[model samples]
Structure formats: structure tokens, C-alpha cells
Target: MLEVDGLTCRFGAKTAVDNASFSVQPGCFVGVIGRSGAGKSTLLRMINRLEKPTGGRILFEGVDVTALQGRDLRRWRARSAMIFQQFNLVGRLDVLTNVLMGRLAGVPQWRSLIQLWPQDDRAIAISALEQFDMMPMAAQRADQLSGGQQQRVAIARALVQQPDIILADEPIASLDPRNTRIVMDALLRINKHFGITVICNLHSLDLARTYCDRLIGMSAGRIVFDGVPAALTDTIARELYDLEAGEVMDETPDFVTGTLAPAFGTAAVA
Candidate 1:
């Protein structure tokens, strides 16, 4: 459903992403992992057309995203939604209103700015909130909720758009273990149940392994490893992260526990 070819991005002299190429099928869930400054987030942004690529092409259902502009770009962008690490909610807006904003692309700005959403839009927003079990909090201000609740609200907002593809960047970075699980589980549920193509930039290897069907590892603005999580070896991981044999863990999440085994060997580290 999504195709990226020879994608490259640069900021003046620095290349943030280079020659990145990948394809995601419908209902596929993919995770991207890389160290800070490895360009994982850049890749996602480029895919969504939020960050224009210096070269290469991005095609969504046969349309060239790079060539889109004006109304076409706006409409195409509406088909894909993004979730951030920080819940980017209007602190003062009610939860329902926040979700309703997802429909802004389809609604007139005058109508949206005046908080005069159409009845159908309102209904869709409410249903999305219900999907996330945030309906009870619909009347509450965004600031009134906890971090996890806010994130779920953000997800509801995305769902309100009925996006074909979901792009999440470091979505679990700011949450605790429980919240992380909650957010990740919600994303997985949406992908599995609704068949929304999901591409996320993740920091937690365990979460990536447990939830994503495929993994792409990046280093120095280039893709280094792309395969199944179970196939990842200590040597490959070390090379991806630039760590020594025993310096990286194999079993534990977040490099907190587990020992590294011989290259490609099934040695559990705890």
C-alpha cells in the first residue's frame, strides 16, 4: 500500500536520511529502530510528506507524494495520520473537540475554527473515542487526563481521520512501562483489527519484537538490518548499535538485562 524508493533527505550539508527504500503491504505492521540521530524519525516524516525529501520518490496507492501540492497534498496527508512521542493535544480543548480536529482537513477551516463540526464528523469522533474507551473523558479537558489517557486520545483523533496508514514516531518514549504497554497494545489492536498499515519508530527492542511483524534497523542515516525480530543476532545488533559482544543484551528489553551469546546462537541473556 506504501512504497518508498531511494528516499534521501538533507539539511544543507548534513544528510539525515539516505537511499532508504522499503514497502509496506496492507495490514502490515513494521517497526523502525535506530540510535539517536540515526534518521528513523526523518524517514517517517518524509513518508508522511511532512519533511520533504531531497531525492527519491514516495508512492501511496500509485500516487507520487513528492509531486503533490495544494489541495492534493492536503487530501493525501489526510489519508495518513501521525502520532508523536508527546501527546500534542490542545490542553484547553475538550477531548471530543481534540479528536474532531482530525477531520479539519475534510472540513472548512472556518467551521473547524468556530468549533462547528458537522454532525457526521462529530459522530465519527465520538465513535473513535469510544473505540479507545475514552468516551467517558470526552467532556474533559485534554490537560485533565493522565499521560496515557492523553496518548490514547491522540490515537482516537488519528482514528477519527480513518487514515489508511498510521505513522508513529517514538510514541512510547515518554510513557512508563505500563503506559508503554497500553499505547503499544492499542496500536497493535488497531493494526490487527482494522487492517491499518502501521509504521512506527521505536526505542524499545522488546516492544518492537513482540508487536511488529517486521523490523528495520538504521545507523548513520542508512538501513543496516531489515528482517524478522527472531532472526536478529547479538552480532547483528551489536553492529547496528556499535556495541561490543557482552555490551549488548539479548533477551531483556531496553538493554537492561540478558547476556549476549555467540553470533547467531540461541543463548538467553538475563
Candidate 2:
């Protein structure tokens, strides 16, 4: 289990994440949603140690990760893989090499720096690519793939880390709806098949509701709602986004109210 207690961050006088506390069970697909400055990204970054918390501590599998240093900290990060919105790839390198980079933590610095990955490491990277159905593009340059394909390559690289946890920070913000579904499905497969805990910051309510096992709604740097998607009533959504109930209902799918989408097309034409 991963536990975050009183997690907080500040930029000068402004507080980004305020007194946040939450727990994530293994294999849970959790989605964090909020407005632009709602501190969602800051919270995830703190968990990943990319951003430091001013207060509180994070405990992962009984270790206080916030206090880890040097090799200990490095080991923690190696086990907890992070995914980004930008699909951070070395565009100049081939896809297989990029995936092999995930093994850098295990391999010696000299070999990694010289780009001399061993056959075992190369085989593992290829397995990751096969899982993502990107083996055919293994020899292609990273920059040649589209945005969605790049993200898949990124996921394959993360898998090679053998991570216990995956933190995706607004991973699909740059993709269209179809690509979004593909990426979300990939995340689900990771969570279900590998039993890796996934904590993602999502921009779209529809995607979050459709994919996440639980929804965490934040407002003004605080979590306003945390529960299953079905329990997220119109009132709660309105409160989370500072909108009216009717407005929330209008924005969400009809299933939220146990209503069916009226069939049109040929029936309307007749």
C-alpha cells in the first residue's frame, strides 16, 4: 500500500498542494482531476519525488520514501516509474534503444553511457515492445512515431523498469479522443495484467469516469471528492468544478442519471 499523509507543497507564499492525504491499494486505477491550478500535478510530482513536499511524509510498502537519500532514493525511483504528458523520449534515438534505457538503473554506468546494452537487457526491452505491439517499429527512430505511438513507446519503456507503481501526470492531454481511448486502454491493461498500481492525472471527466476505478476530485489544492465514479452525483461534480448541478449534468453522459441516449439516425429519418 502507498500512503500519503498531510502532503503539502509551497511556492513562496502560495500553497500548491495543501494538507493532502490519501492511500492507494495495489493494482488500483486512481484518477486525479481538477482545474488548472488545483495542484493535481504538484501532488503527483511530490509522490514521484520530482517535486519535494514542504510537509508530511510518503510511506510506500512500509518505508518512509520522503526521507530516503542517495542510493536508497535512487532505488525507490527505479521501482516507481513516472509517465509524463509530453512523452519524454530521446527523439534522435531508435525506439528499441529508448526502451533499453529503462535498464540503466540496473546496468553499470559505463555500459549505459556507452550505449552497450547486453543481450538480456535487449531481450527484455523487446518483450516490452511486443506487449505494446510496437515490435514492428523497434528499429524506427522515436521521432518518427505519432504522438499516441510515442506515448505507447513511453509506456513500454516504463514497463522495462519493473515498477511497482506507475504515476502518469496528465498523460493524454496532447492526444485526440481516439488516441486517448487507446492510451487509457493500455493503462488499464497494465493495471489489470501486471497488477501495478496506477495513479493518473486526467484532464477529461469522460475518460476518468470510463477508465478509473476511483475518482479523486480536487478544488483549490484540496481533494473535494474521493469515491467510486458511480457515487459522483451531479451535486458533487458541480461542487468540485464550481458549476451548477444542471451544468454538471449537461456536461456528463446520460448514464450518470440512469438515462439512455435516445436512438436517432434511421428512426428519425423515417
Candidate 3:
């Protein structure tokens, strides 16, 4: 449902994303993995049009997303939602209200500014939180919750948007192992149940291997590997990071939750 061709983004003399090309099928879960400067986040931002590409084109359902502007761009961006590394919520607001803000795209700014969400919209927001097991925290201030709770709330916010695709940029980067599991499970549940295509940028190969249907590895500014999780051979892993496969696998314990690290080779990123 999404196609990217020769996508390049440069920041002056430095190229952050370069000549990358890939497609994502509707209802599929995709993982983009790489080291810190690997262009993973940049690529996702480009797709969401937060970062205008310096060259190339992006097509979503056969329309050129790179060319969208004004009302069309706003609507397209709303359809392709974003979940940031940081839980970008109004911390002082009640959790339910924060989630309700997802519907702001369809509401007038004046109404939203006055917190005048309709009952139907409030119902949908509440239901979304319930789906993520976050209903109990609906009345709490968002900043009052734990990191995991906040992330789940962020997911609920995205859900209430009724987005067709979610671009999660390192969604689990800051949480502990347990919270990591919680957030990852929420994303999995959304993708498997709702068939909302999810393209996530992840630092953990174990998570990518366990949860993603397919993995795309980025190096510097370009895509170096794109295939099913099972197809990410040890040799390719070595080439992607210039590390022995065992060395890469050894680092799994540092990122994944509990006993999940040991299952890197066997798990399906479920």
C-alpha cells in the first residue's frame, strides 16, 4: 500500500537518508532496524512528510504523497499517524482528554481549544484506552502515569485517530524490559487485530525478529537489507553492522524483556 523510490534527504553536506526504496503491504507489520546514525528515523519522517525529501518520490495507494500540500497534506498526515519516542501528550491533561485530542484533526480548532469534544468522540477515545488495558488510568493526569502507561496512552491516541498506517519512531527506546513488552504487545495487538499497517523503527534486533513480519536494515543513509525476518541470515547481519552474528545476538539481552532475548533466532516478532 506504500511505495518509496530513490528517496533521499540531505542536511547540507550530510546525507541523512539516501536512495532508499521499499514498499509496505496493507495490513503487514514492518520493522526498520539499524544503529544510531542509520537513517531509520529519517526515513519514517520522510514517509510522514515531517521531513521533506530532497529527491525521489513516495506513493501511497498509487498517489504521490511527496506532492501533497495544504488541506490534502493535513488529511494525509492524519491518516498516517505518528507515535514518537517520547510520549507527546499534554501531561497536565487527563488521559481521556489526551486521547480525545486524536480526533482534533476533524474538529475545529476553536472547539478543540475549548475542549468541546462530542460524546461520540469521547466514547471512541475511552474505548481505545480500554483496548490497550488503559481504561483505569483515563482519569489520571498523563504525566502521573509510568512510562509504559504513557506509551500505551499514546497508542490509544493513535487508535482513536483511525489511522491507516502508524509510523512509530523507536517506540520502546526509553522503557524498561517489562514496559518494553507492554508497548510492543500493544503494537502487535493493533497490527494483528486491526490490520492497520505499522512501520516501526526499532533498535532491538530481537524485537524486530520477534515482532515484525519483515525487516528492513539501514546503514548510513540507505537500505542495506530488506526481507522476511527468517531471511535475515547471520551473514547479512554481520554485514549490516560489521559484527559477527553472535555478537549482534549477544546484545539482545540488553534490550528485550525477560526471557525474550534468548529466542531471537526462533521467535517471529509476534
Candidate 4:
């Protein structure tokens, strides 16, 4: 289990994440949603230790990860992988080599620095690519792939890390609708097939309801609602976005009130 106890982050007088607390069980797919500047990204960054917290602590399997430093911090990061809104692959490197970078935590520094990955690591990278139907592009430069394809390579990179948890921050915000579905489907596969815990930040309620087992709603850096998608009524959504009933996202009422989407990965992709 992962425990986020009273986690807080303040920039001068402004608190980006205000005393947030939550616990996630193993293999759960969670989506964090809120308007811009709601601290959705900040919370994920804190969980991954990409951003330091101002108060409270994060415990993974009973260890206080907030206090870890040096090699210990690096190891903790390796165990918890992060996928960004922008695909953070090396634009100059081949897809396979970018995936192999996930193994740098375990690879000898000298070998990694020299780009000399072992055969075992190379095989693992290839396997991850094959899982995403990206093996054919293994030799292609990351910059050459389309946005959806690049995100898949990014997912493959995260897979080779063999992480216990995957934290994705607005991963599909930049993709077209088709690519959005494809990326979301890939994330669902990681959570179900690999049994990896996934905490994703999303802007679309329909996508969150489709892909996540749980939804955490934030407003002004505070968690205002935490429950299953069906529990998120239109009133609660208004509070989340601080908007009138008619002013929320277009047709949000229909999606929230209508039948929830079948869990992704188990059902056929549209």
C-alpha cells in the first residue's frame, strides 16, 4: 500500500497542494482530476519525489520516502516511474535505446554512460515495445514517431523500469481523440495486465470514468471528493470546477448521469 499522509507543498505564501491525504492499494488505477492550477500535477510530482513537500510524508510499504536522499532517493524513484504530459523521450535517440534508459538504475554507470546495455536489458526493452506494437519502430528516432506512437514509446520506457507504480501527469491532454483513446487504452493495459499501480492526472471525466477504478477530485489544491465515478454527481462536479450547473464542461451531465463506461482493457476498445 502507498500512504500519502497530510502531504503539503507551498510556494512562498501559496500552497500548491494543501494538506492532501490519501491511500492507494496495490494494482489500483486511480485518476486525479481538477481544473488547471488545482495542484493535480503538483500532487503527482510530490508522490514521485520530483517536487519536494513542505509538510507531511509519503510512505511506500512502510518506508518514509520523503526523507530518502542520494542513492536511496534514486532507488525509490526507480521503483515509482513517472510519465509526463509531453513524451520525454530523447529526440535524438532510437526508440529501443530510449526504452533501455529505464534500466539505468540497475545498469553499471560506466556501461550506461557508454551506451553499452547488456543483452538481457535489450531483450526486456524489445519485449516492452512488442507489447505496445512498437517493436517495428525500435530503430526509429523518437522524434520521428507521431504523438500517439511517441507516447507508446514513453509507456514502453516506463514498462522497462519494472516499476511498482506508474504516475502519469496529463498524459493525453495533447493528443487527438483517437490518440487519446489509444494512450488511455495502453495505460489500462499496464494497470491490468502488469498489475502495476497507476495514478493518472486527467482532465476528462469520461476518460477518467472509463479508465480508473477510483476518481479523486481536487479544487484549489484541496481534495473535495474521492469516490467511484458513479458517485460523482453533477452538483459535486460543479463544486469541483466552481461553475454553475450549465457552465461545466460540455455535456458533462450526460456522462456523469448516464451509464458508466465499461472498465478499459477488459472490454473492446472503441
Candidate 5:
């Protein structure tokens, strides 16, 4: 189990994440939802150790990981892979090489520096690309792909990390509606197939309701609601987003009452 005890992040006088506490069981799919600047991203960054916390502790299986440094911190980081909103890929590198970068922590420094990847590592990267149906584009440069394609490649790279948990910070924020469904489905597939826990930050209530088994709602850098999607009623959503009556409904009418289709009215996956 993953336990976060009173985690907090402060930038000067402003607290980005204020005493946030939660626990996640193994293999659970979680969604964090809130308006912009609610500290959802900061919470994920802190959990991944990308952002230093000012207070509290992060425990994995009862061991504190917040204070780890050097090699210990690098291992912890490898155990939880992050997929960003920007699709952070090396624009000049081939797709296969980008995916293979996930193995850098495991291979010898000299081997990586010399670009002499082991056959097993190369096989793993190829398998990940095939899993996402991007094997044909393995030799193409990352910058040549479209937004949806690039995001899929990004997911494939995360898969090669063999992480215990995937931290996706708005993975689909820039995609079209069809691409959104595709990316969300790919994340869902990874969670179900590999039993990897996924903690995703999402802006769409319908997508969160359809995909996540649990939801954590934040407001003003504080987690105000934590429960199953069904428990997130209209009133609670309003409080989470500080919306007035009918405003939440106006924003996501289908998801508010559980009427949205599972397919999300998107074109068939290509």
C-alpha cells in the first residue's frame, strides 16, 4: 500500500499542497480532479519526489521515502513513472531510442553512454511499442508524429519503465476528443493488464467518472472530497470546483447524473 501522511508543499509563503493525506491500495485506479491551480499537479509531483515537500512523509509499504537521496531517490523515481501533459520526448531521437531510455537506471552507465543496449532491454522496448500498436513507427523521429500518436509513444515509453505506479499529469489535456478516448483507454488497459496503479490528473468529469474507481477532489490546495465516483454528488462537485447550483450540471450534465456513454461519443480507435 502507498500512504501519504500530511504531505505539504510550500513555495515561499504560498502552500501549493497543504497537508494532503491519502492512501492507495495496490492496483487501484485513482483520479485527482480540481480546477486549475488547486495543487493537483503539485500533489502528484510531490508523490513522485519531483517536488520537495515541506512537511509530512511518503511511505511505501510502511517505509518512509521522503528523505531518500542520491541512488535511493533515483530508484524510487524509477518505480513510479510520470507521463506529462507536454509529451516530453527527445524530438531529435527515434521512437525506439526514446522508449529505451527507460532502462537507463538498470543498465551500466558505460553501456548507456556507448549506446550498447542489451538485447533483452531492446526486446522490452519493442514489446512496449507493439503493445501500443506503434511498432511500425519505431524508427520515426518523435517530432514527426501527431499529438495523439506522440502521446501513445509517450505511454509506450512509460510502459518500458516497468513501474509499480504511473503518474499521469493531464495526459490528455491537449488531445482532441477522439484522441482523449484513445489515450484514456490505453491508460485503462495498462492498469488492468499489468496491475499497475494509475494516479491520473483529469479535467473532464465524464472521463473520470467512466474510468476511475476512486476520485480525490481538491480545492484551494486542499483535498476536500475523497470517495468513489458514485459518491461524488452534484453538491460535492460544486464544492470541489466552487461552482453554484446548476453550474456543475451545465458543465458536465451527462456525468453528473451518470448518463454518459462508456465510449464517450468518439470515433473508433484507429
Candidate 6:
């Protein structure tokens, strides 16, 4: 459903993403793991066309997203939504309105300014909230909700767009452990139930291992490891994080930290 080839991005003289290449099939859950400044976030932005790549081609359903312009670019962006580390909701707006904003792509600018959404659009927004069990908070202001609630609302907003692919950059970074689990659960549910392709940049290896079907490890703006979660090893972790094997063991999950285990078995990576 999504293809990235020879993706490269530069800031001044330094490259943020160097010739990264990967493809995600429909309904797959892919995780991107690396330390700070590994260019994971940059890669996500480039996939969504928010950051123009200096070299490479990004194709969504066979359309070259990097070459898109004007309305075409806007359309592509609407088809593939991005959720940020921060919830990025309007603090003062009611939760329903925030979700309704996701329909802006289909609504006229004048109607949106006056907080007017079509009846069908309103129905879609409400249904999206219901999907995440966030309907009760629809009338409340965004700032009044907890971190988890805000993130769910953000997910609902993305769902309202009916996007084909979801790009989440550290969606659980600011939450506590319980909230992190909640957010991850919601994302997983969305991917499974809706069959939407999901690509996320995560800081927590445990979370990534537990939730992602495939993992991609990056270092110094390049992809160093790409494979199934069961194939990840202490050596690979050390290479990805630039740590010693012992240090990697300390960071790996207790069950599978020492040896490779069957997929989704008791001996799991974290």
C-alpha cells in the first residue's frame, strides 16, 4: 500500500535520512525504533509529504507522492494522516469539533470557519469517537481531558478522515505507562479492525516489540535492521542503539532478551 525507495533528506550539510527504503503492505503494523536523532521522525514526515525529500521516491498506491503538487498533494495528505507525539488538538474547541476538523478536506472553508459541518460529516465524526469509546467526552473541551483521552480523540480525528495509511510519530511518548498501553491498544485495534496500514516511530523498544509486527531499526540516518520482531537479537539491538551486548540485554525484555523465541510466544522480546 505504501512504498519508499531511496529516500533521503538533508539539513544543511548533514543527512537526516540516508537512502532508506521500505514498503508496507495493507493492514500491516510496522514499527520504527532508534535513539534520538536517528531520523525516524524525519522519515515519517517525508512519507506523509510534510517534509520534501531531497532524493527518493514515495509511492502510495502507485502514485508518486514526492512529485505531487497543489490539490494533488493536499489530496494525498488527506488520504494519509499523521498523528504527532503531542495530541495537537485545539485546546478551546469541544472534542466533537476537533474531530470534525478532520473532515475539513471535504468541507468548504467558509462552513468550517463557522463550525458548520455537514450532517454526514458529523455522523462520521461521532462514529469515529464511538470506535475509540470516546463518545462521552465529545462535548467536553479538549484541554479538560487526560493525556490518554486526548490521544484517543486525535486517533478518532484521523479515523474520521478514513485515511488509508496512518503515520504516528511518538504517539505515546508523553503518556505514563498505563496511558501508553491504552494508546497502543487503540492503535492496534484500529489497524486490525479497519485494515489500515500503520507506521509508527517509537522510543520504547518494549512497546514496539509488543505491538509491532515488523521492526525497522535505524542509526545515523540509515536503516540497519529490518525484519520480523522474532528475528531481533541482542546484537541487532546493540547495533541499532550503539550499546554493548550486555547493555542491550539489560534493555531487552526478560523473556526473550537472552535467545530468539517463537513469534508471540511466552519468550517474547519485552
Question: What is the lDDT of every predicted structure here?
Answer: 0.83, 0.83, 0.86, 0.86, 0.85, 0.84
Superior by TM-score: candidate 1 or candidate 5: 5
The lowest-lDDT stretch of 10 consecutive residues in candidate 2 is: 261-270
Kindly give the number of clashing pairs for every candidate.
Answer: 3, 0, 4, 0, 0, 0
Q: Report the lDDT tens digits of candidate 1 across residue range 1-270.
A: 798999999999999999999888899889998777899999998888899999999998899999999998887777889998888999999999999988989898899878989998888887777767798999999999999999999998887777899999998888887788778888887787678889999866667777899999999899989898998776687777775324324435533212322221111100
> Lowest summed lDDT over 10 consecutive residues: which window, candidate 4?
261-270
lDDT tens digits by residue: candidate 2, 130-209: 77779999999999999999999998888788889999999988987667766777888777767889999976677678
lDDT of 5 at 247: 42
- In Å, residue 249's CA in model 4 sits off its true spot by 3.7
Off by over 4 Å in 6: 243-270
Model 4 stretches with alpha carbons more than 4 Å out: 244-248, 251-270
> What is the alpha-carbon lDDT for the whole of candidate 3?
0.86
Q: Indicate the residue-level lDDT of 90 in model 4.
A: 96
Candidate 5 residues 157-202, lDDT tens each? 8888888889999999999877887788889877876788999998
Candidate 1, residue 222: Cα displacement in angstroms equals 0.4
Tens digits of per-residue lDDT for model 3, 138-257: 999999999889999998888888889999999989999889888887788778777889999988778889889999999999899999999997678777866534545665644443
| TM-scores for candidates 1 onward, in order | 0.90, 0.89, 0.91, 0.91, 0.90, 0.90
**Pairs that clash in candidate 1:** 258-269, 258-270, 259-269
Residue 94, candidate 1: C-alpha displacement in angstroms: 1.0
Q: Tell me the spans in candidate 5 whose CA falls farther than 4 Å from its real position.
A: 243-270
CA-only RMSD, every prediction: 8.6, 8.7, 5.6, 4.7, 5.3, 6.6
